[model samples]
Target chain A: MTQPRWLDQTEMAAWRAFLTTSHLLERRIEEQLKATAGLTHPQYEILVRLAAAPGRRLRMTELAEGVVASKSALTYQVGRLEEAGLVERTTCPDDDRGVLAVLTPAGAELLEKVAPGHLEIVREYLIDRLSREELRAMTSAMRKTEAALRSG
Target chain B: MTQPRWLDQTEMAAWRAFLTTSHLLERRIEEQLKATAGLTHPQYEILVRLAAAPGRRLRMTELAEGVVASKSALTYQVGRLEEAGLVERTTCPDDDRGVLAVLTPAGAELLEKVAPGHLEIVREYLIDRLSREELRAMTSAMRKTEAALRSG
Candidate 1:
């Protein structure tokens, strides 16, 4: 048997902190989004991603990739959004088989209304907690980790 | 309505990277743990938490808190673990009303087998992806964020 290589104190601390922070932050975000915006975190992410897209629309595949969600999950959320008149799935102008998710006027308005509370919560729990250098380092670390995850 | 406090470009970049990286990393970890250990990430977490506790036992509440899982979720996962003979929920020796999760011999054995693969995956996907200084900064950022989340 190959000997198991263990994480030393530094590595272990980093991993534990990352794991704990991520779990707590995600739960807190979900709770606030649910209570304040009547949306789950994934649903909010879908809205944000669509809102940022050109013409406030994205191909289904592109939105799924942008949100880092599974196709089926994105479809489910989009369906719920459609029911709420927040988004409409339309036939893709660029591809016969593809569909697009476009933010509806109501959805954009809702997003606008929800933005203040959501940003406040995010700022309180995350952005405001970090020093300027820490924020930059976090951004860099995330990018590096994401690149490695993608390549590996 | 209060004006939305928008994230400036730097804040936006940091938030987006954090959101994207966390989502992708979680899915990847769950997928790998499922494939390599026949365990969900939470299940693996439960095992590790139990194994680290003194006498490899912890009360249901403490286990839930330690794993940051909800009571109902922990109960469901514990039931599965019990069925697999990986863990045993026994009446606490010191408190008749308290239930404890104890790592079974089988669970310890399985953890030993799964440790190397899991560690390698963690290193490849996360720990090794960062420079030492980046890891330290990440640790600090996570700690600060987690403390903020807890207090607020």
Candidate 2:
């Protein structure tokens, strides 16, 4: 059998550190959002996307892609948000399978209220921790990685 | 009410890119490992940690902390691994509440067999996608962020 090719020392360190940091950062954001906003990170992302879209609404497929979640998972999350009166779902005018997620005024208000604490957490754990050059590098790396994955 | 402190354009762009890339990268890694090794990313992490530990074993608490998982989640995961004969658990001599997780030779062999495919996925989605400077910046940023979280 051929020997396995492992990540070299530098590559291994970078990969492991990235994994750990991503895990911790996500958990921190989730916990903070849960505590202060009664929303999980994924749920908050959905709200943010809806708020950013024109008329504060998006098709379900668009919403799933925007939040980087599976269609089924997004469906469930959106259903819960709708149940909570934070969002409403309407059938798309162009397609029957298409469902649009619209942010309720309550949802927008909740997001506005939660933004301060969420931003504070982000500033503390992520933005404030990196230098300007580092931030730019990170963003560039992420975009590169995303493009590679899409092509591959 | 106090004024909301939100992320500026640069920070927001970086943050969103990071979030999307991290989520997609993890999904790709998990898909690759599951297909090639029949292991979830969390399970693979557990196996690798056990393999690296002295005596190929660590207490459940230590394992959870090392894997960055909650205790209940670790217990559930370990139970599944145990049923698959990939790992075994024994009571710690010093503490009855403590259980040591030991990697089976089978598990070590599995990881050895799977490491190449896993590393390839990591390379495609992460390591190879970044320039040398970007890689260094990422590692440094992660280290700083992790340190800040730990200290906080």
Residue-level lDDT of model 1, residues A59-125, one tens digit each, is: 9998998899899998899999999999998898778899989999999999988878888877887
**Residue pair clashes in candidate 2:** none
What is the per-residue lDDT of model 2 for residues B1-152, given as tens digits with 9 covering 90 to 100? 75777889999999998899899888898888888878999999999999999999999999997888999999999999999999999999999888999999998999888888888888877888789999999999988988777676
Q: Compute each candidate's TM-score over C-alphas.
A: 0.96, 0.96
iRMS, all models: 1.2, 1.1
lDDT for predicted candidate 2 compared with the true structure: 0.90
Residue range A12-108, candidate 2, lDDT tens digits? 9899888888888888898999999789899999999999999999999999988989999999999999999999999999999889999999999
Candidate 1 per-residue lDDT over residues B9-109, each given as its tens digit: 99989988998998888898888889987999899999999999999999999999778788999999999999999999899889998999999999999
